[model samples]
Target: MQLQQWAEQAASQQDWSTALQLIELAAWQEPDNPQILCRWGDWLAAAGQPEEAIAAYQAVLEFQPGCPQSIAAWAAVLNEQGQFAEAIALLDQASEQTADLWHQRAVALQSLGDWPQALTSCDSALQLDPTAAESQFLRSKLRLGLGDWSQGSPEYESRLLVFSELRDRLPSFGCPLWQGEDLTNKTLLIWGEQGYGDQIQFVRYLSVLHDRWPETPLLLLVSEPLVDLFRQLAIANLQVATQFTFETESAYDFHLPLLSLPERLGATADVIPLAQGYLPRSLQSEIRLQANPRQLQVGFVWQAGETSDRRYQWRQASKSVPLEQFLQLRLQVNHCQFWSLQVGPARQSLLQNWDWADCDLADRMHSFADTAAVLNQMDLLITVDTAIAHLAGALEIPTWLLLPKFADWRWSLTGSETPWYQSMRLYRQAIAGDWRSVFEQLQQDLNSRPY
Candidate 1:
């Protein structure tokens, strides 16, 4: 059979082993064929044999020097093997040989966490082929990582158009942004986006916005559970809209995603204004009465909703743990009530164990609002870097956010505190995915305190 025919049959059958074998047979017949070598190398990499793939691709480069495809394939395998610098060097050579080389270089640099260089490559790729779909998509993602939102937002919108649901979900605003000036006589709809934690974090800016434009009709659209709590915010002209049940006719003059407030505020590493506390008055009043007479009331959220790590497939596959680690910490606290704000599957299992330190909130709670109410009542919240952490931060409740070693950038690095929340204290893992050390330090901190 023809090499192409064999390759096509193997691929169509979903037999990676057979495809690899066929590619090797072809390469053996035409040992100096750069094309065959590159194809075989790619199949090897796809079959999770990056080391072998790199060797095959290198053989191609030996015969035909400056082979861009082989160079790129070698770089990609090196990247997969965690040899970022070597991969980047290969990409540099590949990039010089082709007009679309920058696109390949960007992929290599992104893997190395070199966002700035990757952005430059993305720019070069766009300049080379402005209409290219992959160039447009990657450019947007790299720009977001670089924290360049001025251009990022428009690019994001453009990229989102590729997804029918995302495109449809976007409101027809007639404009890309709100000036905050035209709000004098119009209703401004401020709604949530992204994860629950994102919604909670950005919601704090709503109050700042309300103070900035008191005369504008502020209709805050949030998930149903947050409605009752947000209604009590009681800013002048503040109105609440929950879920899909709200009556509306897109008559608003402007709309903004709540997450965009950070961009509008020009929030930066040094400028995170940590306002001491900002929980709603009604909720505060309720929590104040429930505060224990003798102990430092620290609310605890051990596990984030399972959805938090769903996007990181490799991480999910390798290292995921339950609240058993949390139970160990609970034993160290004598007077503290270890409340479980952990939602979803983990919560049920935790309740079944019935290991909570006589804490009754787990029995009474059913939704996020209940969790929010409990947070308001507590003096401090000890939680994983989850939605509860964002909620506590937005409410300006004193919260100690626990983070994994390789944390998301929103938390930033080299800090014991968050700029977005004055009341938040950060406890991070010293090593990647090492929660035991983090938990040990937290335990010591709890022990040192007058519990």
Candidate 2:
């Protein structure tokens, strides 16, 4: 009992190491106690030791079968580990359903690409507790993922209410959210959100907003890195701002996040505007590189950028393929010259061997535009779901995007194509964490491609 109390105190202070140690000792002392075992599982999961957490949960289920709390916690970890089907089976073992259990079932089903069933489960959860913001946010994603713009768009606002980071970072403006208010004699300031890829993907809405309300001045705020790339949008009334925040209330009449425009713009999967791409024809900045005519020019990015958000790290890792796997594709494919477009700390993987890439462009790329200039010189760009992938697709370059089995909603369930970019083709992993098959298929496609 004292050890459990000490563990709870340590956990509250975010001392996961001490908490885990204390919790493990407490569980060992009271080996038959289901409460202590469940607490140990929770601490293990919080410590990022998922497999150990599963074992702890399994120990609880061994004696106290059909425990709802243990089953829900176990399923949540399974979902995080990309074991969606197993999570669903485990959820069914619960003696009784709670809002949390229903929510876990929906999460597992959603990960398995069963949007309809997932939505039903989400509705059940919401019925149990309408105030469950996480369930509401997930339902919003499911609705939008199914291309239901009308219902999903309104529910999407829950993101602001639910996600603490997003809510905190949202620039506090005195102006109300623009929504669908008339644009005549008004100004709208739209800011970026999420990651570089999200900002790039959603910036197209600015072009739509500009054309719809050309008389109204539009301000687009983004991180400094994307300022040059977005300028290529070429809207007369649009001004891209690099500033982090707004100082005065008078910058614009109404302010909204760039993503908020999709609802007003009436865009769904059936009607993603500028699918051919909105970025201008290759800027004169395009380099005319001289290379061997016998070989095909190929650029590859094997990893996505890192994030401190522990909850999203698994998704981020799912989007990345090991550099060695891509390098091995070079040996199987014929007459294709490969270059590395990977940057950030993961770029260090290239230094492991000199023969991996013909050229590493990490140092040469200073901005998104610089990457575009390089893409202009490439015959094809193959990459994971990164900002570079979005940039390449936006530039209307021939791009092959490698995706995990459980890809982002934008990529949809299973297909070689997406509505977002006509020039981009998708190659998805048939199973989670299996890049070998993806690369094997890619190699065959490359070998069979007519020169």
Candidate 3:
């Protein structure tokens, strides 16, 4: 094979060193080749060198203006870096619009919170290629965000087919999937298939399922850490387990993902079942935090945990806040004790800033049950978009959830109140990647609280 072909093969196999060496030689051999330059730019971007990627794209376009492939690639990187309008302008400069260019434009528009324009662009993409999985999935998220659950819920199934780092890690059952039909003589196995927050949020559907199909055996299999927290649901005719053996597959007539319950149950935003006080109230945990009668206890989680796990590549973006922001909030208050429940990257900074000795409860937390015990005693929980937010909400604890400009679909498009958690209020970023406004709102809200 040619040098360029060898570089492409190495890049596909994730051998960055081999790929870089081969691509460098190939670029040296064919100095004017736009294809090689664009591919090299993509590789650079993937390898976390966006500036170099942009330079490589600039080289290709400088040599050959209106190069569609190079323009699209460069625009994508620009949009990912929060340059929405610039990305769009670059895409507009293209002589002809391909599906990729339209998709890139749609993404940029979506980032700008122009959902209507983004939907239009996405429709244009779907028109060009009716079977595009990525666009279809994006459409689902857009529709759901707009509260059009009927269309979005059905299209959301496209996620299972998409190529994500989390896709292959999801559990697959040999039996057929349940489709909201009669299960008179059948057993349905509901497995938690996503993050801890997802499992916590969706577990509310168990009681509803049991209530509907009184005789049908419903088994819920969640992660081991959650078994203690979820078993307290104590719903009638419900069985909660942490494991599923191959032999058990023979017993289950059908299997369904926990998140899929929404679609199967036809749950719209307006009519969310078991929205509050659904998950076991106060979650009977053996652990509890020590609280002073005179001081208001506050627990906070600044970052999502276990981000290095390849399955949660999405969390690597860091929805966390700077430690200074929380400290600033701390300065404005008096007699309100702050406990850092933050895990992952922010844990070290929190320990250095505060005496971990005072917040030994955070260190002792190992399971969702342990976190629940801390949250149970907390007067209020201030957190980013993490599983801890869901856990606190599950316990009906007062929580202020700070969200990014484009948060997940569960929070919906625009609302202070969420249907999923009555005690939780959302504080979304008005400007993308800017948390200043969010913190300002938080300060006002916290100051008004009667401590």
Candidate 4:
């Protein structure tokens, strides 16, 4: 096979290292080939070498100015780096227009909070290619932001296509995906998807599903860490398990992803399953509270799980506050006992100046169940956008969710309240990346409340 052919084969199989090697060999043989350079650039971008990829794309532009492929790929890398304006400019300069180019432009515009324009660009792309999953998913978020849940929830199903990693993990049950079908005597397998926060947020749909089919047996498959916590639902016909066994397959007649339950059940912001609390009281060991008159117990989680992906890394940074800020807040409040509900390497932040009154449950709290138990003892919970926030909300604990300027779509824009969790209150940064104002507001609110 020719060097270029071999490289294409390797790329098809997702062997980035081998693909890069073959592309390098092909480039060496045909030193001035713009196509080879573009191939090299694409592979480099896929491997997360943005700088090297840009260099290769620039080389292609030098040989063949305004090359559509190089321009689009280069713009994509810039978008990944949060240079939305520059990416938009580059896409506009492209000589050719394609569905992908418009989609990339829409993504950049969306990042800049240009929702109307982003929606327009996304529609243009979707009109050209209706099967473009990423564009469809982006449109769904835009629609949701506008509170058009009727259309948004249905379009959101494209997530299975846009996030290939998530789609690949979905098990094939050899049965049709369960819509709102008759299940008087049937069994349904409800499997988990996305992050812990998403699972917690959507699990409320199960109660509705149970009510609709009171006689139907519902088998829930969740991550191991959540299995114990979800069991608290205690639905009479529902069984919770970490994984699905082949022996149990015959028991279920149909299956559905947990997140998909919303669309299937026609859940809207106004008509979401409103409940005081969904999770049952956790029976796990709880941290002992000190006997002090006029003392308030508070729990806080500052950081999310560590990630190397640039997208998630940015999210983690945006949601997290420096430990110094939390300490300052603790100092400002009187007779308040702060508890560390943060886990992973982020928990080390608490060791800087250990206070005896502040209970540290980092070592003891293992799963969502353990965290829920600790939250049960607290008067209030303060956290960033993480699973703990969702858990507290699910448990009907008073929770203050600190949000960045460009918050997640679920929280919506311009709101102190959320429809998902009635007990949860949102505190957003007036300016992007500014946590001081949020903290100040939180401090003021705490000061006004009776201990």
Each prediction's TM-score versus the true structure: 0.67, 0.87, 0.91, 0.92
Write one digit per residue (lDDT tens) for candidate 2, span 174-291.
Answer: 6788878889999888888778888888888887787788889888888888888887787887777687443343468888987778877776667787878878756657454555
Winning model by TM-score? 4
Model 3 TM-score (2 dp)? 0.91
Q: Looking at candidate 4, what is the lDDT of residue 190? A: 89
Clashing pairs in 4: none
lDDT for each residue of candidate 4 in 1-451, tens digit (9 for 90 to 100): 3999999999999899999999999999998999999999999988889999999999999998888788988988898787889999888778778888888898787777777898899999999889999899989988888788999999998998877766776556667788788988888988998889989989999988888888898898889899889878857878888877423555678899899998898888787685577886555565555636568888888887666655445556777888778889989998777888888887766775657325667776778888888888899999999999989998999999998876777887678988888899999899877899999999999988788
**What are the clashing pairs of model 3?**
none
Runs off by more than 4 Å, candidate 2: 1-43, 51-65, 244-250, 284-290, 448-451
Query: All models: lDDT?
Result: 0.66, 0.84, 0.79, 0.84
Q: 376-422 in candidate 3: lDDT tens per residue?
A: 88899999988888888888899999888877767766889998888
Model 4, residue 349: C-alpha shift (Å): 3.3
- Candidate 4 weakest ten by summed lDDT: 284-293
lDDT of 2 at 265: 72
Give the Å shift of residue 280 in candidate 2.
2.7
Q: What tens-digit string does per-residue lDDT give for candidate 1 at 1-451?
A: 3975798688677688999888888888888888888888887777777778888888988888778778867865665554667867777665344434666677666654566777788788778777655556667666654555566545654544544444565665454556445466777877766667767666666777777677878777787767766666647777777753455544566777676665565444344443554546245323323456677787776665543221233322222344787778777877665566566565666767755635535644544566667776777788876777777776777787877653554654447866668778888777655688878888888778775
